[model samples]
Target chain A: MPIKNNNNEIGDSELVDSARHGDTVAFGELIGRHSDKIYNRAFSIMRNREDALDISQEAWIKAWQRLSQFNGRSSFLTWINRITINLCLDCLRRNKRFNAESMDQIDEESGGVERQLPIETPNPTRRLERHELRERIDEALQQISHEHRTVLILHEFEGLEYKEIAEAMECSIGTVMSRLFYARRKMAVLLSGLRQEGY
Target chain B: MIDERKELKIQAYLDGELTIFGRYKVNRLLAHNAEARRLHAELNSIQELLHHNELDHPLPEDKESFRTRITHQLRVEGEGTSRVPNRIRPVLKWVAASAATALIIFAGVYSLMSPENSNQTPAHVLLGGESIEPEAANASFITFKSESAKLSVVWVDTKSSPVASPIN
Candidate 1:
């Protein structure tokens, strides 16, 4: 049976079942519950607010249409997030952003400039507050190439393995490792620079 | 200087993505090489920073507005995709075409038999019977009878439009 409309107390599983039965209200509730996380994930990938908003809405619509196929193998948010990530990847491929990463590819093949930088012993980010650190990290993410940042997000944030990321990004596992290593080294360089500035 | 491949191998070991032999190789490199050890430490710290510190952003738009947009799109797409079945589509097209053709033929016959046309013949004679006075046919027999039976019996008011009168 469909849950009463606008009821916030219902669990996600119940709402999902009701939504699968064609209850738009239940689906709306689910959207209301998870839109922020969905939007944030999209923003992390796309790095543009308008694109993120568009992708997030598109993801929700797709999730609604494919609700019956969602067999509860993962949580509703996880399932929906997978949809959002796939859409972001599609948008990336459609825009041919990977072609823009050719220079980064050359860098990866040769270990990049960050390879020669000195490795700092102490934690460079130790002085900054958590909020400042997050802001700096986001700033740093925006500076790197898309492929490298994506590898980092997949491995670190989404907890995907190298093979899984390779499949998602449609690259080889070796490429995944290479990009991930480059991304971390680049991040280390950026954070070390921030620390030396006494922030 | 460590080559890029060995550097990545060290990272893989740090991530626990390495097999047992790969791990053993990285362990030996880290134990012997101070540079590899420092690189490993730096990479480990960065991974920890990212793993625990993914930024949480609130939805830029209000919840109600975002939900409304998504629900509106769903409704529009639902209507757009709710199409007629493929098999029934051709049949419906044929039926519509037949109806249109029939209407066109009916209009053409009606216009040809209209009273406004001076060339129009008497209804009985047009049906291949003897030419009868319009009033005489209406007063006695409403049916148009033909010797060769070229046309069936159909009542027509010569004064009014042809199809307005019913068949006898």
Candidate 2:
């Protein structure tokens, strides 16, 4: 007797294929697997719970509508991430509060020379309690511009490569590098102060 | 002393973006320069902190609301109903109005330009010696032309109306 793999335990590509054939259950499973990360990315960019939820849902809706066009050039998660990021960018564009100029001015005002103090002193953040680090990082992330913060989240949190970050951001690799550099610098300066404050 | 080229190379090296040859050059610089080594440490620390900071932040409970809203929207749209009721209703109203206006104009022109209405004649008529009266209320003299195979009943009024009736 030959052993058989259960259809319910299908891989992402197979699930995608079934979803393309109009199987809503397969698509629902895909959503269940990725919704958390997608929601987190949206929250990271939008900084609002409601907006993040809306964007993630919209991304999934768009994925379903355009599923036939997905040619598997990238992983399904990546394809969906691109959709979510684009939706977030659209939301940001509409808000006018999240524009690049306003963000840059805010950073300049808050990020003076005093903000550049070093935070880590031979104690790795990994060694810190996980919950405290999460709180600190989340708070620190809110201080950076959306553009810088997005690159950081995609690169550091999501573990996307520079090229993938560039694709998600619709920018050149050099731009991704430059943005990542400035973002890391700003984060270091912010987190360093928080550490010294003993938070 | 940190040269400008070396500083840029150090940043690239920390980012893991340097070519192998470029990394070798920066490594050579690091071997002799204390400042280069410090810069490397600072860069490395930043990367580590950024990577580890947000690893465990669970999304808020309300985050799922967006997904629900979007799914509802997609369902509604996929049903093929109007997304913008106000916008589309006005457009449909305009199209209907324009069609009605065209129909009225066509009916009016057709009534006026039809040959039977102008000639005041039945479509088929036969001829004989018998006298046939005109349908309209007026005195008239009947005239028939055999060469053209035409008949005309001229009303008594100088402002006469043309009529054609069969004589049997």
Candidate 3:
């Protein structure tokens, strides 16, 4: 429980103070604490490990430069997560890898299978272990359209609420929900198949 | 009443967006409906898996390398303000010299035109121009006096009435 507390609670104010006074070590500590989460979010969007890593690092640099402006209205992780998400979104936009048309098309085309896929078949015993389940989820996440993957990651991975996801994604809550629904349905299908596949 | 109530509150409860009453309704429904229980369990498992997955993935290489690169970049930027390309330095120096020269010329012209120095004659006027008054002929005189030392002074007035009479 204490470990959980330590992991969840960052000494953000201390880091901010040190960083404000130009302590790179303190900034690095902050980076080390949040880097994994930031990298994962970036990876969630960019889908390329190198791109994710690059963007996440760039996001940290930007966050350090802008640390003075943080008002602590939200949690520090939330603030950093927002920056990472924005950087990833910019990278995605610049690469022209994701577009509304592609997302809409994915939803329209994939929605039927997405819905028909039984997310939870009554299981007397869960067939796939958690690790295998995770791999399936990762693969399924990759297969979904970028826009939907982003919403799902923000919601499920980052634990952001619908409103926060909408704000970060620069879309409406309705869009976030729709994307989440589609993404979850697709995930359930994919995950069920992984169970069937015995991987 | 229970079915209607559960239907009303399922999403909010599952999303952790519900108030106490809504949660109570969801709890009550979960007590009876196997489907709701299964769905909630699935959702919770999915959320947990996603959060755990974030921890599971290794830190990307770009992150480590980029941090090093960025820190080095910032240090270099801080220490080396003169890192401007060699090609541009000469051009900048030339521009700076030209600007200084232009400023000097401007200041010189401004000072010359200022009213504070209005009485100063233009250099061109002193070349060869004659005095405006007409010259008088035979208007030169010499005076000598012996006092402590013999002093002789020569005076000339061309425009005076030719010294109407000789000096006494």
Candidate 4:
């Protein structure tokens, strides 16, 4: 039977149900609804337009194939974004983006330089507009290592718990905590520095 | 100086990942220690900034185009799943085996054809009665080259029997 309901007028749950029954139009509607969020989530981590585009497409394809497996434990967007994040992580791993050592990894691992730096009491986001703050955050995320950046994105944006992040990142809870702490410290520094630079 | 462990505890507190006792301890620390309070405030500001202001980047391409690409990929991958295992696996395996065998044979032939290090002459040239070194009574060494392989060969023989056909 054809799904007679208007696709845009319907909720994601109804679309999901119809898509699960092999309705390509319903699945395409779900894609149309959530593709930007999925692509943004991928872009937030991958930081490359072409890579983000490929991973987002792959995520949707995988979502279509596994639509039957989506149990609706979470929101449909959340479920699909999880797939996008996983694909991003896998692509990062395949490309060895996470394995490359940098000063961020050294600071994170070897009794951090960030550890010795004093805390800035002034709020980094106090004087800035929301878009400015977001631009600063994106710039800072780009400067950090993939591990630190991934942990921050997972915690701050995805709203994943420490344990959930640990599972997704395939590391210990301690590692997640350490990465999060250092990532926050780095963000504090970057935001403060960017504020000082007036950028 | 706030230790690393204490700092992480403060972060965990800010993130609400701490248990009741941990929260209480962190609260006490924040109340007593000026530095910990500053750290907490800083972390909290950053957290709130991140949580509220994640830059919303819309899909750079049109949604319809992106959706069409994904749909095309799904169709391609769906066909691949049905066609790959039963039909393509044997063909892929055969192609792989043929490639491997060809590589090995080419490597062997190339190595054999390399003659930069060779010093001996061809056997046919030797047999053509070119001026040759006289053989010793007890042993003799004959040096030649292979026509097919373009490699030099050295043969050693004793008075009793031929010890080796090709030594080099």
Best by TM-score: 1
Off by over 4 Å in 2: A1-8, A97-121, A161-167, A170-175, A193-199, B1-8, B52-75, B81-168
Clashing pairs in model 1, backbone N/Cα/C closer than 3 A: none
CA lDDT of each prediction against the hidden true structure: 0.78, 0.65, 0.62, 0.76
Tens-place lDDT digits, model 4, residues A42-71: 999988999999999889888877776788
- Tens-place lDDT per residue, model 2, A96-170, is 755655555444434433234432433443355667777877888888778788878887877877888888667
Clashing pairs in 2: A53-B66, A54-B66, A57-B67, A119-A192, B128-B167, B130-B168
Q: What would the per-residue lDDT of candidate 3 be over residues A1-199, giving only the tens digit for each residue?
A: 0112342355777666666655666666677677877777787777888888788778877876677778888877888888988898777777776675465555444344544444454242445576766676788887888877887877777778888888877777766666776666566665665445543
Give lDDT: candidate 1, residue A31: 92
List model 1 lDDT by residue over B1-168, tens digit each. Answer: 988888999999989999999999999999999889988998887887787788777778888989998888776766775354323545766776665455445644764766564333444334444434344523433443333223334444454443344679
Docking category for candidate 2?
Answer: incorrect
Report the lDDT tens digits of candidate 1 across residue range A1-199. Answer: 6677556888899999887766778888899899999999999999999999999998998898788778898999999998999999999999999787765488554676788888854435346787877888899899888888888998999988999999999999998998898889888887776656554
Name the lDDT value of residue A19 in candidate 3: 64
Q: Which is the winner by TM-score between candidate 2 and candidate 4?
A: 4
Error of 1 at B50 (Å): 1.3
User: How large a fraction of the reference contact set does each model reproduce?
Assistant: 0.67, 0.30, 0.23, 0.68
Candidate 4 regions with alpha-carbon error over 4 angstroms: A102-104, A123-127, A194-199, B76-168
Model 2: how far is B47 from its true place, Å? 1.4
For residue A163, model 2's alpha carbon misses the true position, in angstroms, by 4.6
Question: Rank by TM-score, descending?
Answer: 1, 4, 2, 3
In model 3, which runs have C-alpha deviations exceeding 4 angstroms?
A1-12, A73-75, A100-113, A122-130, A194-199, B1-12, B18-51, B62-66, B79-168
Q: What is the C-alpha DockQ of each candidate?
A: 0.31, 0.15, 0.12, 0.29
